[model samples]
Target: MDGNQRETIHKIEKLLVERGLRARTIGSTDFPNVSPMKAVEQLMRQCSGAVILGFPQTVIHQGISKPNTQQEKNITDKQLPTPWNQIEASMAFMIGIPLLIIRQQGIEGGIFDIGTTGHYIHTFNLDNYDWIREPSFLQPFNEWYREVLVNNN
Candidate 1:
C-alpha cells in the first residue's frame, strides 16, 4: 500500500489480526530478492486466501470511455486502484483460494464489478470508517475468513 492508504491498511490489518489472520503485502511482508513476479507467486502459493483492497491509485478528472468506439461516453472523476491488486487477486483465484474484495466507493470495473468473481464486492467510503462496523461488510468478510481458516487446516 502507498502512503495515501497506510491508515486504511492498518485498520484492515487490525481486523485480520483480531480474527487470528495476518495480512501480508508484497513490499511490506516480503521483499523481492528475486524477480517481483516470482516473489509474488511464491507468496500466493503460501496463502490460504486473499483480501483485495481496491483503493484509488489513479483518478481521471475528465476523460472518455471507450474512446473512438460508438459507445463512447464522457467520464469524470473516475477512480482506479493499483493494478497490482487485480494482478495479485487473479493469482489467488488461479490458486483456487477464497477471495474477499473490498472496494472504495466509486472504484469500479474489472474485478471490482459485481459478479466478476462470484464473491460479493463490498464498497465503502474512504472518508469514514462506517463500513467496518456494518453488517454488509462483516457478513461476507467473516464468511470468507471462515473459508481461509478451513483452508489453513
Candidate 2:
C-alpha cells in the first residue's frame, strides 16, 4: 500500500477504535486475484465489521488502440475485475455496511496531497457501487467518512 492509503487506513482504524468498534488490518495478499467477493467472505468470517481499502488493477480487454487522455487510461474496461468495486458490492450485499472507495490522484513533491488527491464514494447497494465512475473516485474519501461514518457514529 502507498503512504496515502496507509495514512487513510490509520485514521479509519483510529476512528473505529474510538467508537468501540473492532478493526483489523488484512494484508493485500488476503485479497488475491482482485476478488472483492472473496475478501468480503473472509472478512465476514473474521469480523462483524470491516473496511477494505486498496487500488485494484483494471485490465483493459478490448477498447481504443490507446487512451485518448491520461484519465481515460487510468480507468478503462478491462479483462480483470477491480477489487474496489467488488469489495463495495460485497459489503453492500452482505451487511449493508457502508463501503467507501478512495481513489488517489496526482503526485506532487513526491508526496500525495490527501486534500486535493483522493476521491470518495458511498455504495449502499451493490448495483450503484458497481457502476461507480472513474472521476468520481477522485474525490477524497476521508471527508465523506468524517461526514458519514465518524460524525454519525
Candidate 3:
C-alpha cells in the first residue's frame, strides 16, 4: 500500500484482526523473491478467503472509450488499480475461496464493475472511514466470512 492508502489498509487490517481473521498481502505478509505469479500462487494457496482492494494506482484523463470504433466515446478522469488486483481476484475465484472486493470510490472497471463477478463491490471514500462501520460493508463481509468459515470445515 502507498502512503495514500496506508491508513485505510491498516484500518481494514485492524477490522479483520478484530473479527479473528488475519489480513495478508503480497509484499507485506509474503515476500516476492520468486516470480510474482509463483509468489502469489504460494500465498493464496494458504488462505481461505481473499480481500481484493482496488485502490487507484493509475488514472486516465481525457481518454477515449472504444477507440477507433464506430461507437467510440470520450472518457475522462478514470481511475484504475494495478492489474494485479484483477489477477489475484481471479485466482481466488477459481480457487473457490470467499472473495470480498473493497474498492476506493471512483475506481472502476474489471472486477470493480458491478456484475463483473456477481460479487458485491463495496466502496468507500478515500477521505472518509465511516464506510467501514456501515452495513453495506459489514453485511457482505459477514456473508463472505461465513463462507470462509464453512470452507474451513
TM-score of each: 0.92, 0.40, 0.93
From the highest TM-score down, the ranking of the candidates is 3, 1, 2
Each prediction's whole-model lDDT (CA): 0.86, 0.43, 0.88
| Per-residue lDDT of model 2, residues 29-74, tens digit only | 2544546556656665554333544342444546654467655544
- The digit string of per-residue lDDT tens for model 1 on 1-153 reads 566467777888999999988887887887878887888889988989898989888999999999999999999999988888888888989998899998888999888999989989888886776668788888888899999989998
Off-target runs (Cα >4 Å) in candidate 3 are 1-4
Top-scoring candidate (lDDT): 3
lDDT of 3 by residue, 1-153 (tens): 567598888888998898899988877787878999988887888899999999988888989989899999998898889999999999999888888999998998888999988899898997776778888788888999899888778
Could you tell me the lDDT of residue 35 within candidate 1?
86
lDDT of 2: 0.43
Model 2's number of clashes is 7
